[model samples]
Target: MAIDPTSPPTSPPRDTPRLSTRDKLILFVLCAANFMVALDFSVLNVALPVLGADLGMSQSALQWAVTAFALPSGGFLLLFGRIGDLYGRRKLFLTGLVLFAAASLLATFAWDPASFLTGRALQGLGAAVIVPSGMSLLTTTFAEGPARDRALGISGTLMSLGFTIGVVAGGVLTDALGWRSTMGLLALFALIVLPLAPGLLPESRTPDRPHLDVPGAITVTGGLLSLIYALTTAADHGFGRADVVVTLIAGIALLTAFAVVESRTDAPLVSLSMLRRRTVAWGNLGGLITFSMMSTVVFVLTLYLQEILHLSAWETGLVFGVQGIMAVIAGSLTPRVVSRLGARRTLVAGLTGQGAFMIALLFLNEHSWSVWLAAVAVSLASMPHVAAIISYGLTVTSGVPDEEQGLATGLVTSTQQVGITIGIPLLGVLATTSDDLLSGTRLVMGIDAAILLVGAALIALGLRTWRSAGSGAVEAEPVGSR
Candidate 1:
């Protein structure tokens, strides 16, 4: 049965629905698809030097390998999300899967920088469709309760692990096989998931869903593209460059125009009122904070280990591999934790734990032993970090109507991608401003921890209001609703 946001659910919020074998297979297909999307974000990092050397890309131009994927990926998310809702999500999902696979193969076989960059950009465009579509599909498949919670826990775990594992896998694959193998691996994943999806996942067929919002789509997509480009460019070059400055202005202006257009349009691309909901607003902000701060932690620590501690790429990867292991453990246990404590409290506590560990990394230095200490910090922190990641997803999708799950999940997916894309640049800029690399790393970590604490406080306050207003469950009534 479909659900409306304002009305109470037909079933008990915490009731567990039994999953059939078919349901389990559907869950696997959806989560695996999302895992592939997450893997694309970081799997190419260790291969970049090799890729650039082979493709004749300069140091400045090399960043484009990653940036190329990020631009269209982040930019077109909302547009494609709306399209999936209006058209058929299953078709969109298949299209993205095929596009991603083809693009990955293209990048794998490219003989020139132009071709490689084109392939990467197209991969990003495919990712823009996959993430929101996959997420919306998952939510709509299972009702909002215990079964959905379990599925989300698995999805969140895989999503977090995909990022950390990508770094390690990139190094290993680049060493064993050529750099091309990394791109080839994603295409392989698509081959496996594509066949499963077509047979299993249900297509979107909401009768009351609105028509395409052309003006809203144009303004928002333009705004996101400009803004993401500015951020990605600013990471390498400062914000003062002519291109960066112009894009930054264009992004802001276009987004502001988008807001105005959304307000006046009969069929808005994104519902402005949805953004005003206590859970939707604060939940997305929480996701952005967790993803940006935690991901920046990994990056800053990786650089600190390599540059200051003189650890090799292999050693640095080992240090961070512990994070992936701990993330898996934490993700598996999160359903039980959420069952005991609601998503609201779980989010707050998770932030507190994650922030505490983040602050502990401030002591990192050049000593060899600091590597172990850093590893410990990240390992312990991964539990709560994973917790925050899962809980934020649970929180945001809790009260949304079934028809708008695409829009709701789109908002969160945008935050996750934008956070990954923006974190390095925003914090990397701060880390580099100081002449002392170690000091700059610590400065950024400290700032990130502070932001987490402040975010936790604000989110708690927001959820408290939501509870007082009679919606006791901050997320789904199910224990592992993420």
Candidate 2:
């Protein structure tokens, strides 16, 4: 029988497949890669002082080791994401792993600040490719609904755990094997993962592959780099610094031009129409809010625990270690929560819960008992953070085609990095403005809580509208359609 070409195409029913051995192996490799990238972000923090001393770096110059990595990692995300979509995700993923490993090796052997910084920057570039490509692989491998949800839950847990692991690992490695061990460990991990990836991961690319959007890529990458640089610099140098102001303005102008270019380009790096989708738009916004507030909490707590309470680095790591454990447990439970309440409602509940916990931080003080209370508050906060992360990821990627999964994941990852970059400076300024540190901490916590609540409200409203529109569309369909 010949099918009529004029007939409307039917959507495929969402199906969940049982995980086979190969499937499980693929999941493990992807999660491990995600963990490595995330771990790189925080693992160096504990080693920074010792590493700097060994490299003869001054106090101020030491900060660039972090900035060097962060700038390219965040800046190149979108460009690489689209590249994965156009080229091949598996190839990009493999390239990222190899590059990251080589950079790690270089850093391990670096004899000076400049050499180490070069390695760190290269590692960042590799991570820029790894994260989105890795995520695209996950989404494409697992079918939507239960399968993708479960995979995302595991992936998010590992990512959150990676940060905690990095903190603890950095301390232990630096103390036992010296600062070089930190970079060496990363190199070792990358080498272990590299060989397995080629056999385990599958290749994927868009069907109607379009030409690369050079102009859009250039403008967006330049813009994000400038913005991130300005944000980070403002944390140490005042916002009024001439270079910071100039860079900030240039970033804005370039980003505006990117929007214009994307709107008119034949093969756009980011589809403007995708941003108009409710889930992608609102989900990214929610992610932005979650990461910014959560990161600020970490920054403020670090100061409180160390400076005000006079706790050692090990003690602070222990406190966060407990929080990280809770985050993993929470991430494990997210799939169940989503099954019960759905992604939108889950997101709202998670956001609200996190806000409530942030409000509880208002009572924390310098007393020993207060430190325990702070730990408890942080532990409780992790549950919602994990929930929100998984839910937002699902929401953003839910209906997107496999071809654009890289782009979608890129947006999510980019917002997360941007949030982290902006949060420290934005909230740091607030914490510094007050006369007293305790008073400043309280003020910032209050503001963070408010922002979380506002974000929840906005998401809840968006969900309501989406549901209403969905219902209307359904009702308009013919009764005998099936």
lDDT of 1: 0.84
Model 2: per-residue Cα lDDT over 167-188, one tens digit each: 8888888888999998998898
| Model 2 bad stretches (over 4 Å) | 1-17, 468-482
Instruction: Give one digit per residue, the lDDT tens place, for model 1 in 76-145.
Output: 9988887888887889999999999999999999999999999999999999999888888998887765
TM-scores of all candidate predictions against the true structure: 0.94, 0.93
| Residue 411 lDDT in candidate 1 | 91
What is the Cα-based lDDT of residue 65 in candidate 1? Answer: 92
Least lDDT summed over 10 consecutive residues: which range in candidate 2? 468-477
Worst 10 residues of 1 by lDDT: 468-477
lDDT of candidates 1 onward, in order: 0.84, 0.85
Query: In order, how many clashes per candidate?
Result: 3, 0
